[model samples]
Target: MLPMEEKFIYTDEEKERSEQILTELQDTLGQSFLENDLPKLRNHLSRSIAANAIRRNVFGLNPILCALQTAAIAVKDIGLKRDSVLAILLHQSVQDGNLTLEEIDSRFGEGVSKIIHGLIRIRMLYQKTPVIESENFRNLLLSFAEDMRVILIMIADRVNLMRQIRDVENKEAQRSVSEEASYLYAPLAHKLGLYQLKSELEDLSLKYLEHDAYYLIKDKLNATKAARDAYISSFITPVSEHLKAAGLKFHIKGRTKSIHSIWQKMKKQKCGFEGIYDLFAIRIILDSPADKEKMQCWQAYSIVTDMYQPNPKRLRDWLSVPKSNGYECLHITVLGPDKKWVEVQIRTERMDEIAEHGLAAHWRYKGVKAEGGMDDWLASIRAALEAGDNLEVMDQFKSDLYEKEIYVFTPKGDLLKFPKGVTVLDFAYHIHSKIGNQCVGGKINGKNVSFRTELHSGDTVEILTSTTQKPKQEWLNICKSSRAKAKIRLALKETQVKDGLYAKELLERRFKNKKIDIEEATMGHLLRKMGFKEVSEFYKQIAEEKLDPNYIIEEYQKVYNHDHNLNQPKEAESAENFEFENPSTEFLKKNDDVLVIDQNLKGLDFSLAKCCHPIYGDPVFGFVTVSGGIKIHRCDCPNAPEMRKRFGYRIVKARWSGKGTSQYAITLRVIGNDDIGIVSNISNIISKDEKIVMRSINIDSHDGLFSGNLVVLLDDNSKLNMLIKKLRTVKGVKEVVRI
Candidate 1:
């Protein structure tokens, strides 16, 4: 027996509206789409829209209906593919309806499911928390790394949202939305080559964020609309006639500047609307083949400039080298009717399509197999994501995203693009992480420059490297790219890990000499006795030679003795019980104020010379003195020459045999502008480097300038140089010279 099958039924109105929408989609997508995929797509969309009709009041509109409309716009208006349209339609399915990714995969395909998954992730990021807007935007870009179609859907969705923002009633919500759209979404659209969408987003955002100013400009524009149109007609009539006589197929159209753009100009120039020149642009779109676009565009530029005097500085030739986002157009400003400045844009029909629809049109006009223009951009986004999450990383990511790009050349004549204000160190890292780590400096156009040199366009750069050079922590402040900073941090962490392991081994060997087993408990006890919070901290101190291993061994020995003889009577130790025998009378007379050396070198005593104040890690020698047993002097000290001349044989070869725990004083002189925060800023910079300790500071401010001397305690020359480099990066610091 056959079971009766149930069929889903649609109401008369639902069927009529669904047919209408499908017909519209057919008209926009052409007959091939209707014959191929429209029936199944229509069935799914109809059910999805019906299910979502109950919760369609977020902005007092049906979200599913709006989504379908947006998808159709993406397909017909923006020339997107069938998968893109389907993804757009179901982007919110999981969040809004009973549909799941599994069901979508079964109905549509894996491609649609993947795009929908990316879109859902982005939506979840938005809905989670209002943390850092820049971080959220960065994550959004990172999401695009998985599927670029996600960004296209997001742009289309934003366009639809901006179109319907006027229906929302809450002023505060509207303002918030507008500000985000202006600052974040508009910039993204611009970066993606969606010129029309960017303009609309910017204009709508300005209308909501600055309502009063927007209306004032809008009213003024309306008041001058008739006059501006007449002027445009008069200005273009002569150019139109010339192009016609030249047998060129072209259509010239007038474009009014967006309100946001005009507002920005007014604020920058501090002028009223009337003072703003070139309020509109005339676009001349030529009908030419893809191969002839560049030639025809330039030919049209010649015709337009022949009618008016062109501003030399205002001429932009983008036809030769398109923008990074794939926008191709030639622009020029000229003195037009009534001596007013008028801007003109010349491009072929293919170029016009790209400018209008952005990458969407690029894919369609260039065919599906053509190279995707966003691979490099996606790579950068993925790099940032792999760098990890933090406020500093977010700031670097934003800087890379929004800053203007500059083009430079390698020694091999290959062109490379980097963000403006990028230093040579950043360029090195862009080539490879290893190269950046070992970079000493570089040569720009055959002249040597520091690694901190800001690169400019068209400069030939050659990175100089040395096998011994390594990345210093201070390089983080010098390199502008996020990738460089991330790599530097990783390298430093790996080095520290290795050093920590070596320190642990050294401590273990010392413990073994005392006949004590080195275990976790023993290590913990030692860390507490040494005032360290963790074993790793104790190990790091040992590795840096900041803490003496002998001191650690003595502490553990005391514990060992106490545990073995808790009940024994305490006995006062006499001077005779000391390990070192009393120095001979001759030794006492020779050593007046010299401190006692370690037990291993019991017969010797020495004091660091005041002339050099030699610290740990310095190349030093011991000098036998009449009153002092031995005086330690740096190898390059000023007194070394005089001493050698006076008593050459008195000098004996000496090196630091044990850890030096005492601090050594060093002086630094700084000169800079006498700003209010100059002193505090310098202090802050010095404080941030953990290895250096400030002893004292003396400053004199006069005539809007300041000179200061700082006495700081440092272990070695490396720490001193690092501190000096950090001080030089301060805002008012002009010079940081070692005194």
Candidate 2:
């Protein structure tokens, strides 16, 4: 359930959109590619779109276009390679089950597959959760520290998503996506020195979260355009003239601050829009040699400082020691015309590109050198991350106070890295494919432990394997790394294929023993009649023992006699048996229905969504599902906003009908002090109400607080409220909420 996936509505629209993106991809190539590579590139794009043919992402946008746009940013704005672009494009195809990593490796290369592997490794972090857990976030940082390109591609992808979400009707999704953008993507962009993208992400996030505040600042800035432009011209003209006269090759440009930054300033300073001064900054990008870049920047800084009074505290010089991401700049705030403050940034073209494109541009510069390449930087990061067992000792990464990963040493003293919460089974798989297939258990730090035993960093690990032991389906959940999971999947698939061959041999023997003539037509009819689409599936079922050998032989005999005149099987359309009559004013008026689901969707039936049960007299909306049924979800349902944003065309306004006469099951979460008999007290209140059926109650006490889920059957929202009020009156019951 990453956004823009699932619930595929139309195939033709996807094809049309894919064709458009393919053109854009060709355009993106232009003259930067070899003529001989065009056919291969076309073949790759064709295969990619074919795999992701029916999928959409980012509020009902084509996922292929989503990737194409991100690749465009990575190439045009971030200066990434074709490999990075291919990773971004084909990663979704692999994730959506349409393609495989092995296929990518065979068709493209191991390099592209590696980057896609990194992308999928950390794909779970983008779920629609209120807050990312501390441990998960740290693991994410570890993943980012492993591959800086993943961070850049993800930032680019998020930027593409933020720009497209404005037309989405789901405000809740917008707010959540906007908030995550503000919290994670913006900071990562800033840290990577993608200042322009960082500011744009911040502004878009503000537009989604605080609509009024964003527009208010935007309006103020718009209203003061004349005066602001005059002042900027006055400041830049003088600076430009002085720089030119001083024999410096440079150009100066001034612009207003981002609306988000201005709004933030207004809040932090506790002032109105006009109260914030220094609302803009002027950038001086110098065209200088790679060697004279610093000297020229200082010379330009001197010319500006001499004209305006420089504030000592506002001076920042990073020319001597560039940021880790290779951002080099000199910043200063000075008193300008009319005693107003103005911020100034001075850097060379190379420095500016590094600041604009972040690590990718830095990589471009360092690609010419021999030492401290991207691989070396990542190796150093991995070493630092794995160097500590106690994160408290590491003074840096306060937000990630404790690195939630563990590093263990092999018996030969070789070091390996693993995220925290992984077990010895994962370690075995990381060692070798054969070892994982035969892994039984392991001894950690000279202490024998089960395959499920969690290992800590700095501990020596020894893996135990038996040739007879084989992988089981349950082992899939035991391993955490993508490589281990993929190996297990491959091993299981190989076993299944072997088992299928064995089953086929058994079937042929049975047919020969029964003296029955075997024909391909007979097998096809028998397979279809037995509810299997593929002949391999029929054999696979027999291997798994879901299909009986005797049953298959009997069915084949029956099909051979009757299936000759039968046409090939065609899928049946499921027509729902129900009615949605016009809403009565009596039922409708009681709810004050703004959303009246008056018409029955042509052939689809509707049901209340179980995630958020829509009780009688509750506000609701209809969502068309892939199952050809409409799910009625509460207006306030957590997933409602996402549904609206993604499939707005399929959304139907709904209201509860008064004709309903049913007791809906709702789960209520009750929290209070862990007093004696608190659970008993709550249960008694539910039991006392003869109208309300007390379904079940599960209680847990933690840190002197009582928290429990109380499942109860109620008639409607009114009764739900009454029961909640009664529960609140109980001793030690502090809060009650329907979930």
Candidate 3:
């Protein structure tokens, strides 16, 4: 650790700020905080904070330091120790290099060091693979990490950064940071139950990503707040009065959903703001507890639905189990007096607390004694850590974090949450570590489930684990849960290590049988030839069946092949036989980098240009570009038949296997009489298909006629044709044409 003499001393202004923070920190720590520890705590916190800035090359630590100090103060209020506070202050410092691990270990306890290390690991572990970035993948992996505070701290840090990102000098840098803060950090904050922080991050992020949209929404919201309040008050009057007359006790509050959320809903549903169904949601915070809450909410749901006609499909009952994020509420979408759809959420005070505080707050309120089965999840993570290597555990962590989870139940009504599309192997692992290891099969709701069977919500899963059954290495590829994958890998690695020793012994025995004494020199040469510098690497490969012992014998035998029956070498005889000498080794070496335009390339069929949707998985032919590359076009591609007729010689046979995941943008032109809800009708038809994603819409209406073009993502021509047919079925008496 840096000594007091070497540590940075705060300026007068900074000292004052630090002192103010110290006061609050002491309050939070209370009797646990030692007065004598103040100087050392200051040094650690300062070094960590300073190190983070310097390492990220974010120089001149005026505001950032102030922000860090403020954040430290805020986190201390949560009752963290001096080390935890210091770590929080300097969380990013290691990556920045303001302080080293040695300093951290010496200054802070191992627990603090571990937390810092976990943070570092999370940063490094994520995004190492290209596939982990998918939002679904990320959420799946996070669920298994079992460290809520790590994620929470990171989120807090991001939130703090976003609040002060504009103070960053560089324009490009500011935009980049803002975009990330909006896209990732904001949504994460919302999901984590940090409502205030989530909204701020989201609004700030939107300010950068869609400044015009953000301001437009903000302006409209500000202008309408009073009017909106009046409308809500008018709407709620009858419900409140009726409930009072009915002698039912309830509380009502008005809420407008976040602007960002509204914007996303509009974009997703392909509708304008006016068309959104549930902009304003009425939340009823009930005065009840655990058992009575769900029953009371259901009774209330019945009462509300009786008074207001509800969209049966729109009713969501999460009060019974709550979301994985700890959000619990009963939501109902009902037609109000004016026939407009309005959403209502009902929840108890305890549920509301969990919704806001999530797992951490729950732990604070009830400790581990709260019998919710979350302990099993925590145990799974600890088990995964103990049984797996760093990389293996990291993979499991990511899978759990990013996956959409399914909440199932056992026969006895115990709740079980599995990652969406989880297999029986995951269920086995969830039951117990050993069961997962020895799981051979499973029965879901008394039906024999295949090993690859995807589990659904409400399934009662029973694992069939055998003592003889072991984790298959192939399971690593198929397992969805990080815990299962990690444990499997750990088991495989241990088995491999054991097998490697056996292979080493076997190799030594073979050498002895052949009278070939394996010395360090011989082993080194063999190892180097195989691209391994260590004997252990060779043994491991041998154990893995990657290297053949017979190959070694052949290599040794080849040495004598050069000096065959003649006194001269074999090369002398070859030279005598051949009048023409072979070229030098350098001349014989092929330059593979040279792009070869083969005569067979003409017959090699079409090469799809991914830039334009060539649809290689459809009937295709080549269009030779002037830039010297063949561009494949689908037979029905607007340009294809024309290109084929013009350049017949370039066109080659292409066939479709009919499998594709990539989306192709297809333009559809619709002509119809102008009418209200024409766009809505068209959108309903397009969206109902489920397979199509509308990329953009251009509507042109003039002289009582409506004509527009929609750019939609489709899988193939069939889907495009189907969409066109569907659009024609709309009641405007319009013609749908593909453009």
Indicate which candidate wins on TM-score.
1
Ranking by lDDT, best first?
A: 2, 1, 3
Q: Estimate the lDDT of model 2.
A: 0.71
RMSD of each: 21.6, 35.0, 33.3
Q: Worst ten-residue run, lDDT, model 1?
A: 575-584
lDDT of 3 by residue, 1-739 (tens): 3344454545688667667776776776666544555677566556554653322324234543544554563363222344455556555666567667677777665545655765775665343332332343234324422344455456667666666555567657767767666655655544433556667777877776687888877888888899777767876787777666755567898778888878878888998777778877898777765567778778777777888899888888777776565667898998876676789988777776554444533332222122243333443433332243221122233323333566454544455656677888887777777888888888887888766678865466777878988777788777899987887888877777777899988887877888876655556544443334455656765675655576565444433332244234445433122212221223212211111123323233234443234432355555667666656556677766666678777655544543535556555668998776677667656645667765445567799898766766666777777788888887883788654
Best candidate, lDDT: 2
How are the candidates ranked when ordered by TM-score, highest leading? 1, 2, 3
| C-alpha TM-scores of all predictions | 0.45, 0.43, 0.43
What 10-residue stretch in candidate 3 is worst by lDDT?
587-596
| lDDT of candidate 2 over 1-739, digit per residue (tens) | 5344544554686567756765666686565444644477557657655544555553777666677778777766666665677788788778877679998888777767877877885574332221332323423444443355677788899899999889897788788788778877876565445668889999999999899998988888788899999999999998999999989888888999889878888898999876775677999999999889888999998999999999898787878887665668898998999988899989998888655444534333432121222333332333342342221122232223224556566776555668778889999999999999999999987889999888765567899999999998889898888888999999999998898899999999998999987999778765543335566766776786655687678767766766665545546532110011111223322432233464732323556666776777787788878876777788899987887788889887776544444666677888899886666556556655667765445567789997767766666888898888888898888999887
Query: Model 3 Cα displacement at 495 (Å)?
Result: 28
